[model samples]
Target: MALSLDTIGPDTKNTAKGRLEPAMPPENRLEMPTQSLGRWSASQERKPVVDRSRWRTYLARLFVFGGGLILTGYGTYEMYQVVSVSRTTVLQWLLVALFTVNFSWIAVAFTSALLGFFALLSQSRGRGPLPTTLSCRTAIVMPVYNEQTSRTYAALEAIHESVEATGLGAHFDYFILSDTTDPEAWIAEERAFLALRQRLGPQARFFYRHREKNHHRKAGNIADFVMRWGGHYEHMLVLDADSLMTGECIVRLAAAMEADPDAGIIQSLPLIINRNTLFARLQQFAARVTGPVIAMGLSVWMGRDGNYWGHNAIIRTRAFADQAGLPDLKGRPPFGGHILSHDFVEAALLRRAGWDVYMLADLDGSYEESPPSLIDLSARDRRWCQGNLQHMRVIGAKGLKLPTRQHFATGIMSYLASPFWLFQLIVGIALVLQTTYIRPEYFARDFRLYPIWPRFDPERALALFALTMGILLAPKIFGTLLMLLRGHERRASGGGIRVVLSSLIEIILSALLAPILMLIQSGSVFQILLGRDTGWQPQRRDDGSIPLRDIVRRHRWHTVLGLLSGISAFMIATSLFLWMSPTILGLLLAIPLSWLSGQLGAGLALKRLGLLRTPEEFRPPAIAIRANELQQRNATFGYDDQDGLLSLYCDPELRERHVEMLSPTSRRKRGEIETDRALAEAKLGDAETIEDVLAWLKPKERIAILKDPALLTRLVGLKSGTSAIKAAE
Candidate 1:
């Protein structure tokens, strides 16, 4: 009666030729979930009322956005006036347009940050008190690809323990949904799942499933679960491999959902943690400091029409199933095909169906990690760039809310803005070149009182540049001031002076890294435009150091481009060279910058110096500490290098567990050719031992053999002593 992994046993009642059959009924099988096969009707759902506060939010946005546009327009007019004193040619007009576009991007950011600062300052108190126990079942699902089994399972175990501590553990179930492709990784996940079950004991409400085909990747993985077991649970909490949430936060989210019937999804703000690399540490500091202010502003403006960040959020299972069934887009990849960035689109769909999506900005104890280096970050950015660009197709989808379209537009612009900035720089250089080199045709067109001189008022230009820099850096200034105002946070960050010093260092580093990111993102945009598709790959989470040669290979082009641009600017004018010095310097040092970004020693040295210290790093949260402890405990059991077939052949219990977890395939039509099964059978017949099987079979053949029950039977009957072992050697 005790709940355990083994209790969910194989079908003992049914057998075919003495082989055990799957225990579950056909409808309840792992592969087949009862699906509601039809388009969800919007007319049946009650429409959501517009929030009254939206009027005030709209007014605020208009004042801020309109003021920014007016300011940028004035700046553009001044630049035009400066160019008009000289020959007003096509080149000058192009420069004006570029400047306006680039300036508007930053102007909007500045105003948003200013609004965010006010919102943070005016935030109200906590969400009253916790409710007494009474709720529907919630499943906490962690969908994984090829990842380190120890870390992922350890995080899950820690989370399970945290939730159990709250006395609400019985109301929740845990699932490890794997889409792992690598055979080794797949076996490792099974081993880890077993180990986790043992550690938690028999009654632990934990389950694991590995798909034969990844299908539509992650979206498909979740959909498979929803269609199958989703009928049992009222709500589902989604977590990434690296995600960690405290029990209090989880309980609060569930209680809030129960209180609001119209709520479809609720998102929590996840802060970065456990990062040691220099780049990662800097990112952690910035995210911890400035992320809250921006989130508060967004929450105030968006209200119930917010966004989902894919993880660290909970969704109403029925609402998501009925409303968020995504259809494939038309045509080929990089534009058409399956949705890569599915979370945003899901949120839009839910909203379009009259369900409210909200974000809890003030909620704490939610945590995640960042990539360790600039190169790693850029690699991840490449996938995101492609995904965001694909949203142009979805932005025009029928019945989507206006704010949802804006969200899609914002995602698209986050990548496009980089190329815009780069183009602006190129155009500015061209304008300077024309002014300094080409002679003004004073008498060619219309008669003039004086010969036109291509020139700018240097003092006014310098003042304008100063204003732009101030606007761009104002968010950092406000974030720092806010931290200093709070007594506990200031102390946790190593005092006001240290916090101030850290902010300055962060600013300088961010400035140097900006141009490098600009170039990387611009290349990503170019590649996507050229029809290059970025395939899904697991992210590297751990950090130590990267090789110097690898850094050089990745950033060599950036360095070369920097040198060429720097030399060209200097040759044109000292002022132009001076103006471009920051970008040039960042580019010229790209290799070294990237190298230092991944250096653990450099980051630790800063920690020793009391720089870039966050509250979490100083005090260390309970959930984070527990995760590390579990990870270390799990690390002692190392995985075997032998293939899946070899490992399963050696262990009877493992083979049984694996067979029990597989989807029932006995109902396949007669004479249907299973390529894997046929090839596996052919290869197994000629094999003399386990070693022969390993040597003769390819990776695909091995996977096929492992999945087929008949092939596994032959594998288990093979000779298993010193002769077979020696053959393997």
Candidate 2:
């Protein structure tokens, strides 16, 4: 909370406060000294990294499973009766009954499935020998644009040290891809980069390149590198400005890739370990604890052609180059010139070309930072949502095959899952109608000997119920088992039995929060689909948490609905008295859900009570901190200092105006362009020589101006000094 200042100030000042890495180039170019892919004599399809069966077989199974689920759902829904509301007594009861049985199955099963998947992955981690052979050259690209050079390099240094420990450090190179425009910061980056290279020596490579004209945002930044130096390396591992990974995991991924030659990509599921904010911590914990099973199930299904998040992933460079050229969707924001969300598209493209993309859930030592607040994550999601929606264009693209279709569907699912929440509202209304109106048989005179049960057919009910259980609950059940088997439930989780209990509580709380998020996400999706534009807005990177007021304000609608549901349940269940009170009381559960959207969640509770501390387990190594520049070096004319931070000793526009002030030749033109400050700052009467003009300035500044001699040569003052005297005559 105390560190929130610099990240939240006015945009201009925030930019100013962060020290910029020194200038490398205005035009960003990613050039490496290594040989191109075309230059290599080795087969482009060589299997140096991944074992073929593990990669390819996984891909085949995932598609079959996902495709089967989609097909089954559509088939079952089509066969079911389409209800037309009619006042007929039996028909209305049937409609309400149908809604209760089917809808609950879908909702409950989905939750169960999520839990089961994590269990499966935890189990997988304990059993398998992770791929460890190091045969591929992987370039870890860290793309930075006006970020803190010290912290960025520190994180990179931490990773570099981790990498050396793996003994495969020679296989990986670090690229500090600078996109900063500030001359001083640019210079700082250059100096830091050089320092890092010196420390890393030959095994660890450091590259510094700049782009003067930034066009395509982050995607284009990487694309530029692909075009320039992409051919030199076999694969590229991407990290954001704030991303960090352990060296051992890096080697493991490479080993996995080498062990399986067919693997086109390996996506490392990142854990957020540094976040202290409420919004992020919730996301971080959910991702860390709840994540493994889902990732495991996903890994189980998606052997190859899995999701490719923009960061913490390794890509086969040659295959990517040959197949990953993303066609610009012609239009405005959301559906823009360059693909904003190009990772999925690229993955799909690679798969279409018969390459395998794998999601490695078992790997660790990879870490990523999170947005400190809700508004921040939402802002980031807005861009992603729009970009994924654009992938709809690629779904129909001629050659992509079935895997691409499924991948695109997965992308849409990222935001579209919210719409399904609307179904719950419909089901809840049906629950009210059925309970209140359809009186239980013999409710008036229930004999002690036998009570009549509400009737629905056993076979139809059982079939639908089985499918629902398999799809939803199975994943969660599997996850729990995985953790137990892997021994992580006892080892990794600091809370012994207490941690498992906490996780269960977290899951239940998260489930209620889901509906509320569903509402928000659904609306956000609609806005994008309707052509609303989002931006490359920076996410909040501070440690300060979300406020409770924000939660209440944002999710109040859920609270209102919850109260209404509770009330409606009571009125219906009154006939059954306290027997039905629990169902009705579920409405009061909304209060906790609403609070979760605020600071009352475990994230904030942990920070306050120091209960769920993530520990200071994550930080960059000392070498990285020392190697990165704290003070920016300024350019002192002559040789443009590679290590110098660039500060404008003179603005060309300002100098040009001064030139006009010196001349009688362009006096009218000069006055038109000059600002009041420049005019006020201007001194008209000078002793006339360059030396005389230089006398008015401070020693360092004056010498700086003189150091660039051509500046004196081209000044309008000298050009028109003789002209001014002639004109006076």
Top candidate on lDDT is 1
Give candidate 1 misplaced runs (Cα > 4 Å).
Answer: 1-45, 49-53, 124-128, 447-453, 640-643, 665-686, 695-698, 720-729
TM per candidate comes to 0.91, 0.65
- After superposition, which runs of candidate 2 have C-alpha atoms over 4 Å from their true positions? 1-136, 180-204, 258-261, 423-474, 546-729
Candidate 1 displacement at residue 38 in angstroms: 17
Residue 457, model 2, lDDT: 37
Tens digit per residue, CA lDDT, model 2, 136-173: 68888898886666567777777877787666688887
Error of 1 at 648 (Å): 1.1
Question: Tens digit of lDDT per residue, candidate 1, span 70-113?
Answer: 87988788777766765677777887887787788777777777
| Displacement of the residue 340 alpha carbon in candidate 2, Å | 2.6
